[model samples]
Target: MHDSVWKFVCLRDLQVPAPCQVAFKWIKLYGSLADGSHSYKIRNNEKHIDWMRIGAFFFDSPVAILSEKLSLPLTILNKDNVEKALESSGACVLSNIKRGIWIADLQLVRCPVCELDTCEGTMQTLEVRNIELFLCDEYQKGSWDYELIGSYTINKSVDAASGGIFDLKHIKDRAMAGVFNLKSWAGKPSDMQPKAMITFHSVAIRTNLQENQGLITKYYAMRAGFEGEVVSIRISQQLA
Candidate 1:
């Protein structure tokens, strides 16, 4: 068992949807989720859909707007003429969309023994059951747009009966050894709630057998992101 780490980021309004309507958009313009064919391939091969949900500015430094070249180069093949190649090579275009800074809380859980041939093996996975966003007093007056742009679930193995026998004692020992830190990294109070809660179907952890211990640490680790819509919103008497 290991401790859970939390981080924070800022979210900007890329393209405002119609007032009071939520439009979920992909955080990255180019990804498996953006293409139907790629999504199908992932679902078929991996037995799960790999999609990332959240998108925001992750750095703490001041945001800067880099200058874009307005004129084309005279050379037929030059570094400046590689925009199309870059786009084709799966580069993301950072749009100059309306920007807003919203605090995002991230939680990461680490497991000690991710894989074992015996019943002692435990899967380390994080399932974001739901997300609640609590808007500030200013934004609480009127309805706002909420979108569930892109996300997916990965279920490695569902055959509970086929796995090794459940060991309650082993599980208890592991749980006791593990330290969970759900505290906010930004010094926010533990009781603080978000303005909205986004819920989705359960997404399980898909683990892969680690052959090269030198390269990977965990036995099973599925890297995915969560971006979803706000199905419901509740106003809190206390401000976040």
Candidate 2:
């Protein structure tokens, strides 16, 4: 099995507004499922209750998404070539046209170390104390799976000197300072025209927390909107 690590950003700190409502869609492509017929399916499900937080990072890579759903083994296919084939088919081509946060009503819970009240109806918010980067590895000889490898947290006094507002630039810069090897992992490939691909969307929130705690706390406390796209792609040399 091959392992690959990826870096992700929370973009801006997020918070739960009212009733939590975060959603995700999973799309799968079946290439000639033993009948020489092509088919695809889309699933819209709510995010896990424990994951609905402001500063949580998730696996948003295309390789991770494709590896998680495909059941039957198929030959490796290039993404660019797949797109060209769909365009030539004359059918309606669907792709990720819009990026960035679409919704922001994700629910959040306090850290276990903190002595926050659970019964209080007051809105609870949490900051990303440390980001646990996800590592994707090949599983079951053909499928891809993910796990947490390591994490990095910002030092409020060292990183943010001025201490007025948490700098988004500084946070991202620190998060991506290290290098990761992408050549060790495999990518999606198909023998037939792929019917679907996965796309990731983000959601930002405004919180009512305080700013004097620390870097993460202050950042989430201050109501500021930041926007950027954090995406990466890796192709496999081997074929199925």
Residue-pair clashes per prediction, in order, are 18, 4
Query: What overall lDDT goes with each candidate model?
Result: 0.20, 0.20
Estimated TM-score for each candidate: 0.19, 0.20
lDDT (Cα, tens digit) per residue for candidate 2, span 1-240: 111110111232222111122122111101111122110111111211222322223332211111111111112122334434423432112222122222212333333233445532222222111111011112112232221211223343221111111111121232222111111111122212112111122112222222323322211211111221222111111000
Provide the lowest-lDDT 10-residue window in model 1.
159-168
Once superposed on the true structure, which residue ranges of model 2 sit more than 4 Å away at CA? 1-105, 114-150, 157-200, 205-209, 216-240
RMSD of 1: 21.4
Residue 73 CA error for candidate 1 (Å)? 21
Point out the worst 10-residue segment of candidate 2 by lDDT. Answer: 38-47
Which tens-of-lDDT digit does each residue in 12-72 have in candidate 1? 2322122221122222221212233221132223222232332222111112111111111
Name the regions of candidate 1 deviating beyond 4 angstroms.
Answer: 1-86, 91-96, 100-104, 107-142, 145-240
Relative to the true structure, candidate 1 reaches a TM of: 0.19
